[model samples]
Target chain A: MGRYFLSKLIQSLVLLFGVLFLVFMMVRVTGDPAALMLSRNASPEQLEALREEMGFNDPALVQFKHYITGAILGDFGNSLHFKTPALPLVLERLPATVQLASVGMLMAIIIGIPIGLVGGFTPGSVVDSIGRFLALIGQSVPNFWLGLMMILFLGVRLGWFPTFGRDSWNSVVMPAFVLGLPVMGQLVRLTRSAVLEIRGEDFIRTAHSKGLEPRTIYLKHVLRNVAIPLVSVIGVQFGYMLGGSIYIEAIFAWPGMGGLLAQSIGWRDFPLIQAIAVFTSLIVLLLNLLTDLAYSIIDPRIRYGR
Target chain B: MSIILQVKDLVTKFYTLDGVVNAVNGVSFELNEGETLAIVGESGSGKSVTMMSLLGLIPMPPGKIESGSASFNSEEGLCDLLQLSPEEMRDIRGGQIGFVFQDPISTLNPILTIGEQISETLIRHKGLSKEQAREQTIKLLSQVGIPDPELRYKAYPFQFSGGMRQRVVIAIAIACTPKIIIADEPTTALDVTVQAQIIELFKELRDALGVAVIWITHDLGVVAGIAERVLVMYGGRPVEIAQVMDIYKDPKHPYTLGLLRALPSLEAKESKRLKSIKGTPPDLLIPFKHCPFASRCDYAFDRCWEEIPPLISVGEQHQAACFFDLEEGGPRHD
Candidate 1:
């Protein structure tokens, strides 16, 4: 187990570094950092001074080496637009993004799994049909459109909750729901299929033949078997939620990393963009690692080396 | 001996897109107490379906029992297993009658421990506490002849070998001391030597616990080793039912005779190659108006095609669904 953990950790590090390199290259390839930093009307002398200060004058390899070494020490320079350390700027919004993602994931699991189980257990039932209908809308209808609908219905007309900004608990609900709906849809389908597949298994018949209560058979026997794929979908959905929340935050004015990201990209804030991308990649890689570990724990048949 | 369980006119069918598939049609038999009854048939012969339908293990919707009544004498009273509520059936399923299905690898839950799987029945049917169930689980595991019971109790299904896994499945089946065990080809997936061992285990359990067993398999060899009475199913119905010795010594039905001929017997001297029954079994989608075995039977005549032959008593404790009078004509060749 320790060896498995170590190998996974190493793989994550390599992935993190690879992502960092790609993001760094992308920021550089797009446009000049100095040109974005200084105003369009700035004098050539001022632009030159800024470029020298930011190490744009150095060789590309040297600049990359400097950037990576500093990143290793948790230094990502300062955001040109905000005039604050990029790492700290991203960290300040991390909790809010984490909160939105976590709530979205929690809601997806709570709502989606039961629907999946029901739909899967009885494929042609009313509950299954309803679940499939909802999932269809969830998957096909864009989240941006859903966010707008929620805003128009719940926020603007109904006055049930505040429309924009992360002021109260009410604000998180709309954005979180919009983000969770698509994930929940995917989860419903996945869970249903997984359940359907598991239901056909001989072990299920064995459980039934054991005279176990339906509740025990469903939860302990069936659900436990369904958990591995369920957890993986959750992990993948979390990463997707993180990436997809940018538009959601913009629509709802939720002051999360997504908002930070949009503003940084618009302003061409190189350091801030790089920091956020690296952090997001690290988190995604870590989540995948955790998912692999969870598989071994959930199903004893799955061992690391053997 | 008194009958432990008696099934009559149990008709199970599968609804497919094209048409309804008649899996098991009007199958009926008796399982006597403390006796081993083997239901023998080739693949798709409804042997497994008959056993699964008896336990209510067949999933509804696609698969349904059109008509049937299985009367099992439980401690509460004699009740038709087919008519009992799901809750009542639950009490009888693992408690009164245990089932060991084919493919032990698929039969055992991959995630749960052997102890947990065995204790599940003990807790539910026997009402044993967790601690007592664990102790009994260890005993059951050892009873199945696993080398180290304590160590194996915590082991998963994948950790055990094929024969060992079947043994664990057997352990779970016999856990609550069920009156009758319905084993559907339990040893079919095992190696030859292991098959013998599983057969031996079944006999030992039957003798020790005095529990009647309904062992379902296509292998006549395994049946000869374990079962006393043999049920030969052909095309979703029982074509012949007789004692083990009678099935071998003086086979009556053409299908049963074909099965015996197909077996590679050590006593045979002339023929180097084993005799195989000519032609395939009939498709079960269409209704069987005549004998199901008519097309495949060498002795099939004009009467065989016109009407379904009922199982008539040919001798004491022997029955065959054949129109021909084999007594005077003797065995016919193609």
Candidate 2:
């Protein structure tokens, strides 16, 4: 188990560094930071000074190493637009993004799993039909459009909640629902298929033959079996959900990392963008690793096997 | 001997998109108390379905128990198992009648520990408290002959070898001291050596606990070793049922004769190669109006195709579903 953990940790580190290198190189390849930051009419002396300050004169590897060291020390230079340390600027927005993303995920899991389970257990029932219909719209219909629709109907039309900005708990609901709907749809589909497949397995027959309560058979036996697939989907969905939330945040004007990301990209704030990308990649990699660990827990073969 | 369970004209079917599949057609048999009754047939012969139907384990949609009456003299009372409510069936299952299915690799839940699986039955059916169930579970583990019962109890199904896993499945089946234990090809998935051990384990468990067993298998060899009475199923119905000795000594039905001859017997050594029954099992979807084994039977005639051969008394405590009498070496009228 320890060996498995060590190997997984090493793999995650390699992946993290790979993302770090790609994002770092991408920011450099787009345009010279020194030139992008300065006006076109700037003198050579001024350009040289700015270039030197930004470490643009140094070799790419040396500059990357300097950036890496600075990142390690929690100093990712300063956001050009905000004139604040890029790491801190990204960190400040982390809580809001975390809150929105987690709420979106929690909502997806809590609502989606039961719907999928019911649909899987009874494929043609009314509950099953309703679940599939909702999942279809959730998956096929663009979430940004859904967000806009909510704003128009729920926010603007009826004035049930504020149209924009993260002020109260009510503000989080509309944006979070939009952000979560896609993953919920995916979960519903995945869970339904998973339950349908598991229902036919030999162990399920054994469970049934055991005279176990239907609740016990499904909740204790089938659901635990269903969990591994659900966990992996959730892990993969986290990356997409977090990535998509940027647009969702923009629509609802929720002050999360997504807004920071959009603003940073528009202003060509390399440090801020790099910090957020690195942080997001680390989280995603960590989640994938965690997903792998969860597999061993759910299945003993992995935990105890050589 | 008291008939613990008697199934009559149990017909199970599957309502598929294409058409209705007549999976098990008029399967009827009696399981005596404290005796191993082997239900023998090839794959897709509905050996498992017959037993599963009685237990109410068949899924409602697509698969359904079309018509049946399984009178079981359970601990609760003599009730038609087919008519029992799902809740009642649940109570009878794993309590009054235990079932150990084929493929232990897939039968046991991969996530749950061996101890937990066994204890689940004890707790549910036996009404044992967690503490009592755990203690009983440990005993069952040891009873099934696993080494280091205490340590092994905590291990999952994958941790055990094929033989050991089957042992765990058997342990769960017998955990509640059920009146009848239906083991559907329990040894089919194990190696030859392991198969012998499982058969031996079944014999011991049956003798010790005095639990009637319905051992379902296609292997006549295993049946000869363990079964007291043999039920030969062809297509979806029983062609013959008799004392195990009578089945081996003087087989009645042509299908049973073919099955006995197919075995690698000492008397058949001069034959060079073992005899195989010709042709596949009948297509169950079309429905059977004639003998299911007619196409494959050596004694098949015009009458064999004209109508279904119902079970008829052939000898003392013996029945065969065939128009031709092998004893007389000719066809017999109704």
Candidate 3:
């Protein structure tokens, strides 16, 4: 188990380097950072001064070396637009994004699992049909439009929830629902299929023949056994939620890293954009590692080097 | 000996998209106390389905129990298993009745510790405390011949060998000391040597606990060693029921005879080839109006194709669903 953990940790480091390289190259290739940062009214002298100040005049390899070294020390340089350290600026919005994503994922799991279990339990029943219908709408409908609809109905018309900005517990509901809907849909499909497949497994039959209560059988025998794959799905989904939060943040005006990302893109804040990208990728990579770890914990059948 | 379980007119069908398949058509059998009743049949003969149906373990909607009444002699009284509520049925399950499935690797949960899997039955059915159940699990494991029962208890199913895993399956089955254990081809996946050991273990557990077993298997050799009485199934119906030795010595049904002849007997001299029963089982999609084995049986006559034959007593405690009479040398349709 320790060997497995070590291997996964090493793999994560290699992946982090790969992500860093991709973010650096992708951000640099888009356009000149200095020209985008400076206003149109700025003179060539001002632009040159800004370029020199930001080390845009340096060779590409040299600039990359400097950026990589600074990133190692947790310094992603100053944002051209925000005029603050890019890393800290990204970190400042991390909690909000984390909050929204976690709550959204929790909502997704809470709502999706029961529906999946029921749908899988009775594949052709009315409940299954309704679950499939809900999954279709959830996955097919654009989240932004759903956000708008949620805002229009529950916010503007019904006055049940606030339309924009995260403040109270109730305020996060709309954006979280919009973000979580797709995840819920995906989970419903994954879990239902997983459960359906698991239903034929001999262990499930053994559990049934043991005469356990329906609740015990579903939760203990079925749920935990299915959780290994489900954990990976959840981890991947959360990583997606973090990245996908950008649109939700834009629509709702939620002050999260996603919102920061949108603003950085608009201002061509290369350092900030790269920082956010690197940070989000690292989070995704870490989550995958955690998912692997969770597998060993949930299912003893999964082993490392041994 | 008293009868422990009585299954009457148990009909199970699978409603697939293609059509409804009569998997087990009016199958009736009984399990007596301290005796092993082997349901012998080839694959798809509905032997496993009959056992699963009695436990109400068959999935509804797709796999439905059309009609059946399984009366089990519980401590409280005789309760009709088919008529009981799901909750009541659950109490009867694992508590009074246990099951050991084929493919022990798949039957045991891969995620759980051997102890956790075994102890659950004790906790659920026997009302044992956590500590008590843990102790009993180790004991059960040791009884099934698992080495280092204490350490092995914490190990997962995959950690054990196929035979050892089967022992764990047997341990789990016998945990609550259920009166009846329905083993569905429990040794099919094991090697011959391991199969012998598992068979021995079943006998040991049976004798020690006085538990009646309904052993489902296709191997006639296994039936000869373990079962007191044998039930031969073909095309979802019992073709013959007789004492184990009687069925082997004098098989009344042509299908039973074909099965016996298919075996490579050591007593017989070197032969050209092993004789196999001709034709496949009749498709269950069609209504079963005629004898299921008519097309496959060599002695099948005009009346065999026209009507179904009822199970009739040919001798004391011997029954065969056929119209042919060996002594009379002709079909006895009436």
Clashing pairs in 2: none
**Residue range B1-334, candidate 1, lDDT tens digits:** 9998999999999998979999999999998999999999999899998887877778787899999899998889798988888899899888888888889989998899988999999999888899999999999988999988999999888888999999988898898888999898898888899988888888898899999999899999888888999999999999899999999988888899889888897777786788899988789888888888889888889888998888878888999888776665743232
Estimate, for each residue in B1-334, the C-alpha lDDT of model 3 and write its tens digit. 8988998989999999999998999888888988899999998899988988888888786899989798989988998988888889888888888888899889988888889988988999889899999999998888999989999989988788999999988887888788998899999999999999999999999999999999999999889889999999988899899999999998889888999889888887766588999898789898788999988888989888899998898988999899998657788746
- Superposed by TM-score, candidate 2 places the C-alpha of residue A138 at a distance from the truth, in angstroms, of 0.7
Which is superior by DockQ, 1 or 3? 1
The per-prediction i-RMS, to one decimal, reads 0.7, 0.8, 1.0
1 against 2, candidate with superior DockQ: 2
For candidate 2, give the lDDT.
0.88
Candidate with maximal TM-score: 2
The CA root-mean-square deviation of candidate 3, after full C-alpha superposition on the true structure, stands at: 3.0
- What's the lDDT for all of these models? 0.88, 0.88, 0.87
* Docking verdict class for candidate 3: medium
* TM-score (C-alpha) between model 1 and the true structure: 0.94
* Candidates' chain B TM-scores in the order shown: 0.96, 0.97, 0.98
Tell me the lDDT of model 1 at A91. Answer: 85
TM-score of each model, in listed order: 0.94, 0.95, 0.91
Ranking by DockQ: 2, 1, 3
Residue-wise C-alpha lDDT for candidate 2, range A167-263, written one tens digit per residue: 8878888888888888898899899999999988999899888899999989889999999899888988876666536788899888888898998
